[model samples]
Target: MPATRTLATREAADLIELTRSLAVNELSPKAAEAEADETFPREVFRMLGRAGLLGLPYPEEYGGGGQPYEVYLQVLEEVAAVWSSVAVGISVHALSCFGLAAYGTAEQKEKWLPGMLGGELLGAYCLSEPHAGSDPAAMRTRAVRDGDHYVLNGAKAWTTHGGYADFYTVMARTSDDRSHGISCFLVQADTPGLAADPPERKMGLTGSATATMHLDDVRVPVGHRLGEEGQGLRVALAGLDSGRLGIAAVATGLAQGAFDLALRYAQEREAFGKPIIEHQGLAFVLADMGAAIESARATTLSAARLKDQGLPFTREASIAKLVATDNAMRVTTDAVQVLGGYGYTRDFPVERYMREAKVMQIFEGTNQIQRMVISRALSRPAKGTITVLSEN
Candidate 1:
């Protein structure tokens, strides 16, 4: 979970209180234990489900919470502040729902969306492959139509909730075409020839099970394929466009949490017969951290609002992801400094936050890739900036 603090909101005060109450009572206490054991907390999700948090940011017609993206992100922020793994679980679940929600037909939605949104049926998104990490065009997972069923055979790497999820949203090559050949499928976990390996040990976010999924001749009905046979790339891209904002939100939450921890620590720890927070040097650092958080929050919210307004936000989303994640890495590292030796050990969460921050910079198309995206968007040059004015 990402660390967050109480925000100013009299309107959501009641709801926020309720959200925090459950998080403190149930999620926070078990978070460290779960990370230590490298175990996924299945029951924790169920608890969130009962509280109607899992369905947030979706329409209420299909068992959703009908909340806005802004509200939903803050909720996620609160959850992450206490426990990042579970917060990431919620993020992945929401990601898995993307293709189905954006591309699924009425029949498909009616048949599958309810249980998925129920919060009990965990979901995972399978797009990254051993060969294809950032490049989806290079994906090798193949899905061939056998009679009325699509037989899939390939492997997906770095799948969160891999072995534990109820279903997976898989992207597979349906034809020889690079971009248009791919198709998305909604596959149940226990389906024959579909296997999720044991979780891979990682440096951080240990409580969220990350593993590889093997699909050896896994067959599914044609109805399960999301959208048109050639529309998988669009579905994947669209989902990712939204998904990146979710990550930005996560990054913001983590940065805020780290700053909060450092701030609290600074106020308590003293040197030279004064609290460390009284030192101009440390206070300036805290000021910088707070400034970054505020900026990150602003950028992230701007991107999300643009998305919710149906504007072209690829560049904006990339900007938010890049800024927020980079901020997290910096904030978390400085948080460790405030805690001194204690921060370096497992006794403090600052170290864990640091580890978690590294991955945020790497994933969602790495901060490097985000820069590439922004550059590409900028290279457009206003459709011909240096217009020659030959007088007529």
Candidate 2:
């Protein structure tokens, strides 16, 4: 069952309807089989690209949908409810495009943005390294400037769409300055010395590929740089603020899917000569699941509203990410319990949902990292509040 949504515009409502229709007709049928086979659904992305769903958050000038972040996240949620791997891929794709879309030079945008937003080129973001996943500032990747190119050498770990993407947004150290040493570049996947290592064998989301990208003497043209020197970290963090909201939307969708499945099963399954939903204990659990999903959705949307209004949303984004993922984990686990023995077996998708929910709490800066971000923000005085520095 789809959750009721109140979109601000008829166009947004139509977009959501289109997304839900496509998800049901095209994605849901193949999701289980592809996941079971651990096959990367490259064609599915292309299909979505053709449907104009790949670039909903981008401007229409670059062949995108020009939708607001709120609408885009709802579309993502719709897709995620049917196929989480695809939904995650969509979010990662948006994240990959963020640097160029937000910081690229006019010439660079004119040259590359169309192809990227049009879906002619798929993108991957290269930032996290094996030893410096959380601490990007400590990354060892180097990009030495040549006459007209910057030769890169390092490996980016846990890259989504790794080998399959056509372009990569790479961040590498260009100087010794810890705070301002990194630079961002748009490197073509076909560039020499740029290759992806074998994909990682993960516990879930197998339908989407994750791998380490190796940049060994890969020369990226000077023009490919997204922003000025030493601005990569800023761009990366900004993108992550938006990316966390995307993950929150995906997690909410996953929880919704699980809850829907459990609700259907519970209403159909019998317990003590009545439907399991007739039991107060089970009913309370369903009620909690419904409440959690709504709360997570509201939190994610609130953060998105802040972003859309061009306000400071980093703290809110982290809060949304933390709350949504944690609630998803709970909702999915309860869903499994609702199905009892069937949920434990592969015959039902609740088991897979449980596995998929585990990773949501781990990625996009783990929930622990999110808590740190939130706490640090809380330590500061509120925007309008005056702080009196009095020694205790």
Candidate 3:
């Protein structure tokens, strides 16, 4: 089933069609094999870059597509529907660019933004450490300044596109102040003493490389630092709100893909004289899956709109991440059940979808952590002025 989207302009509609075509012709055919072999599809990314899909949300002046977040996310969703690893890779690449684009000096933007945004160079965000997965304030990575360079030492864990990326946006402690000590840097992948450990063996999305980055007295030029000396955590957190939205869109697409597979199976597979889809019990299950996918898509797009409008959407982004990922988990699992014994094997893609969906809830902030963020936002006092009513 094709997703019915309400696009805003003719350009947006055309972009979607172009994305769908690429997804169908290029990504879908290679996804299963690349994933099964645990091979990274670097060429696909290069192709996407050449086609201008890699920089959809960045400014055109810097060689980006200049589309709004809403449109970029929809394109991401289309890609995810065909190949999730590529969609996630694109998101991480965008997250890696966020600090420099949003906080770096004009000189830095002029120097590096074009290549990074143009997709000529893939990027990775290095924020999570083994001990600081949820609490970035506790990260132990240190970067001590010495004249013209900063000597960095520590490890970053669970970095997507880790070994394959051309550049890294790294965060490290620069002082003793828990919140204010951290600093961000745009480090080249080939910097001395900076090495990536072998990629992790995973449950799914094996096509997307995840590895630990080790920085052992790695010297980064002071000119590569992003933002102020102590603003790393702020920059990381700001990028995450947008990153969460990207994950939400990918999760929604995963759900949609699984639902489409299950629906088709229900229409063809029969336990009795009629198709299983005609049976009330199985029909209702399909209905619920459809509803969940639609709800997740709506929530994801609504959050994107809030972000595009320059509103405070941190709370909404968390909500969308939580809802969409949880929905994906449920939908993908039920898709397997709908396929019966066939779903448990590799013959169909639903099984792979199920495995891939499991991680969406855990990354970009776990669903549990998302709840904490939402509750904290709700507990805070409103920021804007309040209006008082007079007696009528």
TM-score of each: 0.94, 0.97, 0.97
Residue 16 lDDT, candidate 3, scale 0-100: 97
Model 2 ranges with Cα > 4 A deviation: 384-392
Give all candidate RMSDs, comma-separated: 5.2, 4.5, 3.3
* lDDT (0 to 1) per candidate: 0.85, 0.92, 0.94
Give me the displacement of residue 112 in model 1, in angstroms: 0.9
Model 1: lDDT to the true structure:
0.85
Q: After best superposition, candidate 1 residue 317: deviation in angstroms?
A: 1.0
How does candidate 2 fare on TM-score? Answer: 0.97
Query: lDDT order of candidates, best first?
Result: 3, 2, 1
Give a tens-digit lDDT track for model 2, residues 1-392: 68899998999999998899999999999999999999999999999998898899999998889998989999989998888999999999999999999999888888888888886677888999999988899989999999998999999999999999999999999998988999999999899999888889999898989999998899988999999999999999999999999999999999999999999999999989999999999999999999999999999998898788777899999999999999999999999999999999999998888899899998999999999999999998876523343568
Residue 382 of model 3, lDDT score: 82
Instruction: Return the number of clashes found in candidate 1.
Output: 7
Give residue 234's error in model 2 in angstroms: 0.3
Query: Relative to the unseen true structure, what is the C-alpha lDDT of residue 179 in candidate 2, on a scale of 0 to 100?
Result: 80
TM-score of 3: 0.97
lDDT of 3 by residue, 78-157 (tens): 99988999999999999999999999999999999999988679999999999999999999999999999999999999
Instruction: Output the TM-score of candidate 1.
Output: 0.94
